[model samples]
Target: MGYLTCKFVRPDKQLFEGKCASMTLVTYSGELGVLPGHASEICALGDGVVRIKRLDEDGGDERDVVVSGGYAEICNDVVVIIADHARAADDIDAETVRRTHDKAQAKRDALPEGDHQRAYYENKMAWCDLLLEKAGAQTASE
Candidate 1:
């Protein structure tokens, strides 16, 4: 089977760079699956989990990354994902994510209905939830 060179980067650092058989991620338009030789294009990513299936390995060899927001570009069998925030499932701290979610929820509730800050806090809370979900899934699969 053919493989695609994949790189996942964040503002602080690169999270992953390797060859993958397939990748599935969430975009503004919804979920997208990429494989070797996929058409070149760019996509606006959404807050969700990015699943990468490594090449030359069993089907269980997959990595899940939680991405808050960003963009993905694909060209010539190479995929680069630049995200606002990204972390591997195994690297995340569930307690920290839960605390963040709680704090963001509290702040969102304190803001007025029409306050723009409310949206920011809401988004943060949702991102935390995604992280927690990813972490849980990884734990259960282990």
Candidate 2:
């Protein structure tokens, strides 16, 4: 019935900015959905998908964005998402991610049990999996 002014951004660039009918974003606690008149709040972001429903009068217009880490603030029907990383599902090129994931997996495996860098590679691999899944290019995880 109303609209929300939404801005989805990362340090490098602004990914999405516009008005939408509704939006769902992942928080450290869980997925939270916001409509035009949502109560103002702030939440820590988590690695997951964001779903946005557009204000098309015809309806059924929607978009999904994969994001990892950051914060979201809502006030007065305006939602601002400052993400550490954000990418539209449609833009992912799964073939490239698959290759890099394999490399990251190899690097992670090479690390000793106590290696701190192992976590970085592990996170990368996990992110690759998420990207593959969100892009609908996922092959069953082995």
Candidate 3:
């Protein structure tokens, strides 16, 4: 199989740039897998993981990135992810995420159901929850 050039980036830094055998991206619609010579397309991204598998022996290790908010593009055997925020799986801080989740939860709980402001808090908590889950843990209470 051929390799696909992949680039996963955030505003702050480029998380990854190289060739990979394949990758699976979690998007608003769901997980989408891309391989070399895949059809060109673009999709809305969401809060989830990106798994990139390297195929060449000389290349570096595969990577799993957690990203939120942005878009992914595939064209001409290249995959590009321009995320609003992203971090390598190994870099996620579970404790920080738990704390953020607690804060958002508190704000969300203070509001009645269907409150517009509550939606923001709920989304924050959801993102935090996703991060903590990927970090292999959960809220202190759990």
The candidate that wins on TM-score is 2
Off by over 4 Å in 1: 57-60, 110-113
Worst 10 residues of 1 by lDDT: 54-63
Where does model 3 exceed 4 Å of error? Answer: 59-61, 107-117, 137-142
Give Cα distance to truth, residue 81, candidate 3, Å.
0.5
Each model's RMSD to truth, in Å?
2.5, 3.4, 4.1
Q: In order, how many clashes per candidate?
A: 0, 0, 0
lDDT of each: 0.89, 0.89, 0.85
Candidate 1 lDDT tens digits, 1-142: 6889998999999999988999998898789999988999999999788899987665548888888889999999999999998888889999999999999999899988999889899888878888888888878988
Say which prediction, candidate 1 or candidate 2, comes out ahead on TM-score: 2
- Give candidate 2 regions above 4 Å deviation: 57-60, 137-142
Model 1: per-residue Cα lDDT at residue 45: 93
lDDT of 2: 0.89
Assess the local accuracy of residue 41 in candidate 3 as a C-alpha lDDT between 0 and 100.
98
